[model samples]
Target: MVIDMQKYFLNPVSHAYVESGPAITQKIKALQDCCLGRNIPVVQTRHINTKEGAKRMDRWWGDLITADNPLSQISNDLKCDKATIITKEQYDAFLDTGLEQLLKKQGISQLIITGVLTHLCCESTARSAFMRGFEVFFAVDGTASYNEQFHLAALLNLSHGFAVPVLTSEIIEQLESRT
Candidate 1:
């Protein structure tokens, strides 16, 4: 699952931009390509705020990614034509989104998470997925945040209990070995 890899957080001009966005974009793209080649489903999440769902986020951040914003769109660097796009309203992608149901329907018991805001959406989703009984593999190199402190802090916290922190190359190697 790729969480919120939109231009809102990736483009340098954006207020929420992560410095490592470009590097992680390539890492995520490689992971996605490997998954696609192996017939492993790739689920991409777009965080958007609806009037009804924006209350908490609006209050906390004072900003929201509405549907009409061009930055809300997924990054151009990633190929998502074959991915299952999940439009989410909260940091946790599973909330109010049909993500859990969709994964179950596809017989997917594990999720490899990658994307921007490692300390926010990505970490939140990883915790949520673990609580929901899904094994989560968090892509350490394929996720980014506004700064290294936030990024490393999230990885440390998540690795303690919520997720298995891994490199993109490790994931790709495992996938390649499977076939």
Candidate 2:
């Protein structure tokens, strides 16, 4: 479950972008490659702004990820031809997006989450997945934030209850061994 990994939050040009974006992207790509090699389905998500109800968040952040804006585009490094891309209008990827349906269609009850803004979209999606009965494995170095404090805080909270926090190396090792 990759959440809100668009350029708007992972690129340096965005105001709330993560500084360690490159490293995080590399780790996520490695995990993605491992999953794809084993025929595991990968679900990637991007956040897009909507005039209907996402105006509140846009106003609060003083930024908007317009549907067709380049800033809303996912980084090339994290995208793959075989991956499923889900576009969301909110922080929680399952809120209105067909992510749940897609996962169900694939018989995916477990999620390995990686993406931007550890405390925001990533964390929110993790908790939501847990609530929806999916076992969530959250990647430590595969997720990033604007600062270390925010990143660590989210990981701590998530590992305590919402998800199992694992390193990218661990996930790749497990996935490889499974095959």
Candidate 3:
């Protein structure tokens, strides 16, 4: 699952821009391509705020990504046409987003997570997925944050308790070996 790879977090001009966004975007694209080639379903998440859902988020961040915002759109670099797009209002993708049900419907028991804001959306989703009984593989190199410290801190915390932290190349090699 790719979490919040929209321009809101990726584009440098954005207030929420992640410094590692460009590098991670390329890595995520590679991982997505590999998944597509192997017929493994790729789930992409877009974080958007609705008036009702933005209450808490707005209170905390004082900003929101509304549906009409161009930055709210998923990055064009990703092959979204071949992936399932999941729109979410919170940091946790499974929160109010039928993401768990969608994975179950597709017989997907595991999720490889990638995208921006490693310390926020990605980490939250990883923890949520783990609690929901889904095995989570967090893409260390395919996720980014506002700074390296935040990114590494998230990876460390997640690896200790919630997820298996892995690089994009390692994931791709493992998938290739399986086939």
- The order by descending lDDT is 1, 3, 2
The pairs that clash in candidate 3 are none
lDDT: the better of candidates 1 and 2: 1
lDDT tens digits, residues 73-175, model 3? 8988985788999999999999998999999999999999999789999999999999999999999999988888999999999999899999999999999
> Global lDDT of each model?
0.92, 0.86, 0.91
Q: What TM value does model 2 have?
A: 0.95
- Taking all chains together, each candidate's TM-score versus the true structure is 0.97, 0.95, 0.97
TM-score (C-alpha) between model 3 and the true structure: 0.97
- Residue range 78-154, candidate 1, lDDT tens digits: 84789999999988999999899999999999999999789999999999999999999999999998889999999
Q: State residue 42's C-alpha deviation in candidate 2, in Å.
A: 0.6
Q: Is candidate 2 or candidate 3 better by lDDT?
A: 3
lDDT of 2 by residue, 1-179 (tens): 67777787777777767778878887888888888888999889878877885858877887678887888888877778898888787889998888898898989999998988889899999999999999999999999888899999999999999999999999999888876
Winning model by lDDT: 1
CA displacement after TM-score superposition, residue 162 of candidate 3 (Å): 0.8
Off by over 4 Å in 2: none
